[model samples]
Target: MPHFAATLRTGLCATVLATALLGLAGCVVISPFGGHDDQLRETTVQGDGDSKILWLPISGFISDAPSRQAFGLVQQQSTLATVTRALDKAEKDDDIGAVVLRINSPGGTVSAADEIHARIQRYHETTGVPVIASFGGVAASGGYYVAMAADTVIAQPTSITGSIGVIIPSVNAKGLLDKLGVEDASYVSAEHKDIMSPLREASPQERRIVQDVIDSLFARFVSVVKAGRPNLDSNHLAEITDGRIFAADDAKRLGLIDRIGHIDDVLALARDKAGVDEARVIRYYRGRSAPRSILAEAATGSGMNFSAAGVPIDLSVDSNAGASQPLYLWQPPGAP
Candidate 1:
């Protein structure tokens, strides 16, 4: 135990020294050994054939901004950036039979999701490659938005999707501030510069402006869904677009999803659609070790979060980092 403690101390000291040296030199370095170069290495998941199927995963918070990891020592590439890189790589490979997107997320910022959706749509149009979306646990709001780009969508039996809507989260801290005798006294140039300020109740005019913005975004969301799902019963359009979630069965029935199936089933459909009898399932990743199987994720550490006093430091940042950033998200109360 003593030897282990000494080793740990030495490692910490070395990290501190390196950090200091780099800071003094006005240079930022993620790792001394290697860094992310946006170069993706392919790891075959399963099967053996001349053609290949790319198993791309769209998981967690879909953000365009790069995520900080290893206590900001490493920058995990953004989901948008990764998608761009993956599609770029896939387009160059002629042997690529099809692209299967494994989506599992509650959703994120409107801009990020919309941008990814647009890119995928453009990719399919340009390459003529069949894009299939396979929903996992949850594919709500922005998650569903990106799936619009897919030629076909297959959801697991227990998958939860829909929640087709827009949201701009804001907090009202006026009551809390009153209890603490704190006041908001910031100066602004315009009459409604602080439109969604939490310090005070918004005027009717401000409320109207915010509602107008929401309505505009909602209209866009509906339009995107219409373009994606042509067979969707127009009669049920009002019911489906009421910001409610739907199960896999309901989604399929509502024409939001095409079929319900497992990963293997999705793969088979993909291979059949691409007219390939046999094909290797591949995953593109940026890391040192290769994934042992399709389900295995990269070994990239999220990052250490311990302070000198052994207290956990909150180093993570949410996609909604501002006061009133608009989103196409489906984050319910108590959701992570």
Candidate 2:
């Protein structure tokens, strides 16, 4: 314990010294060490430009925190409020031509995703700017909901996209608790006081109640998908949205995505979609602790394509940085 405390103290002293040295040099910058948030990038580009292209990368499950450690990182890039502010700014800026959302994520919470979709739609309606959805490695479930707002969609040939479904996995350790000679004790003013606790398996009635909540949310997901992608065959809505992932080629066949391409391809597609022969392109990132040029995301885990607007990026382990944990709940965390 003493040794551990000494190590923490040493690390703290090193950070302080680093800061002091940088302050003295007037040019040096202290690097973020082994902290949870150090793995993500949050630099958002938000200025008036002649460019018609706007790239927004989804690097983590979006959630509802704006802390530097939460949303402001090198890996867990982008957030709900940041995107909202950027889109709002773009709408007011006549110099900005169009928007392209470069998505690479696994889906998250229904509410956050819907909020972003609504904001994108509002920006489009207000600015008369065409929004293009470009799937990076993947864009699944809630991520695709935001994409549905796009005037057109693009994806990589191998990009994993789609998974139009809702899920809220609950865990119960009551059996384990019993084995350990323990049980949870609680007092409740309402029947749902323990709704979020996993110490005990939910009763059948409780399970039904939770299912109803998820179902209502799922219906909204269906509605958004139906409303956003009109060209998609309406009959296949329920069939495709069974929380299944699709390859770009198959997705295109299903009308889930319009075409197959990468970032540069997305820019070109945006140009054609916006009818701008020479469109200036810009990207919107929240902010960056370290510049992204030196950073590259780790590889995909599952060989099968997984889709979401964003998934976690891990920076501590990768040669550069790994997938990150996002602040917004629009996407889930690395599965426990």
Candidate 3:
């Protein structure tokens, strides 16, 4: 009877936990861009019907767009896709006044980051409204790249910033596969055809080819930085080319960040620049309600069980991207 009761209790607890989690997942944030209590989304013309600040967050090694229905109640917050959608909604909203990009990311994929940055640029060119970037805890690499599009960037004194470089990872797991006794019998037409397979070693010449590609990409990164922060000394183009992070104050001193202040300060700047003292601060995250996988949820766990089976998405960080971090990146690996 005691054993049966224990089993029953365990089963009941599992059911309850699952039920609660599902309920939590159900509270999906339909649209982060949705104006507070309002039905429609579009900026108002004829001198500010009502000032609204759209908050967009770009965090972590961003992957694809988040889904709103993936979770039951609790949903994902600010993502790159959500930010883009928010800008779109805010653009047409007859009530919103300006946008405040709240950056709290260590950078993500280059193409995704570029897409966000380009959208911001488009918003700036098309709309006469002002856009400001407010840095949170840390925003480096692709994070800073996106923020550069903002008309004004505000950061706290110790905020981590910079990391302005580009790289594509090249992995050679031939030895590992050999040790595991995993033979890839798959056949390809060309001798160098197996380049896409991580099981094979990269040729010496291939290394040079990869390096050249990275160098070209790095040049592009510099070009974008120069164009965005034109006020900086553009003469010594290669001086700060190495990948590195910087403190908020140092970033400001280097002409990378505009001011040293918190998110509230940045919001004030957005309001002032948009020419409105009163406005609502809003956010947009489409399909962002999906619950994080158990493994991902426990990414911060000291003894959290992180099994490959429990993970939903495979987050990747290019090794080259880490090594080539421009001389201006702010990352706190073991920070509390």
Candidate 4:
């Protein structure tokens, strides 16, 4: 059955590839790294007569996940490593006059968001280039946190733009385990070592300790927001930072965003701030080299395409499995 399933998958991939080639003639199948070079060259041509406005996208979940190419698949959107490299390149490019951070995210882990925020701040400090954050459909929690580093933030009128707080989720399956007649024999050096273990209920002391950590992190989040938005009224600070999501209009009213505008508006703002009448706009793409094992896998003619648009089959082990970590993330009610 396993062999049959593998054969079926191979046949399906071959059919899909044939269909794509027939339907999309003249399409170039560039390697992931080659695509980045192609895009860079195209943008260089576009900027021949003007300064450049680099559009760096911050899409999907913002995490410090290692490069997806290490798993032999092109990552679709921003990861910390790729985003940092893009900013570094932009900072060194003399033709790049400004940066427009196109943010479309519901946020991710706390440390990852903080790292990206600091990188953006450093880019601005070193280059003196204007940074405009253009919020997309949703930019909540850590998404909004990173945007705070931008000199100006613009959100669409319908954009969901706030959810300022921290959350550390841990599942407790003690009841389920008991129902299944399963007993966990996990051992640790300290009582709090396995405090987040799903097989057992957290003790009151453990709960208190975790709550204290959350409180401290929440206070730090508030301080960062305050520093970024000094003009925000103190009266509305508590309400705005209470982990409630806000629409763009309410966000602007509460001083969470600078304006209600779209990507085009952000482009104009970037141009004006950079003192350039005309500027070429470009976005960065990941330039990851595929491993020899991946190349060998492709050589098998297994009818698989390890491209960005292709579904990834992660063969690498996840380091964060079963771990409880703090997040600056926002999930709408009913979200899984």
Best TM-score among the predictions, by candidate number: 1
lDDT of 1 by residue, 119-149 (tens): 9998899899999999999999999999999
lDDT of 3 by residue, 142-202 (tens): 8888887888888887788777776554456778889999877878797666654567777
Model 4 scores worst on lDDT over the 10 consecutive residues at: 294-303
Count backbone clashes in candidate 2.
47
Model 2 agreement with the true structure over 29-103: per-residue lDDT tens digits: 434543232222223333333555665555556443432221222222245776776676676657556688777
Candidates' RMSD to native: 4.1, 9.9, 9.1, 9.0
User: Cα miss at 215, model 2 (Å)?
Assistant: 0.7
TM for candidate 2 is: 0.72
On lDDT, the stronger of 2 and 3 is 2
The true-structure Cα RMSD of candidate 1 reads: 4.1
lDDT of 2: 0.63
Instruction: Identify the runs in model 2 with alpha carbons over 4 angstroms from their true place.
Output: 1-51, 67-78, 285-334
Which scores greater on TM-score, model 1 or model 3?
A: 1
What candidate 3 gets wrong by more than 4 Å, as runs, is: 1-49, 65-78, 176-186, 285-336
Q: Estimate each model's TM-score.
A: 0.88, 0.72, 0.68, 0.78
Q: After superposition, how far is residue 306 of candidate 4 from its true place, in Å?
A: 8.3
**Per-structure clash totals for the candidates:** 0, 47, 46, 0
Off by over 4 Å in 1: 1-37, 300-316, 319-323
Q: Who wins the lDDT comparison?
A: 1
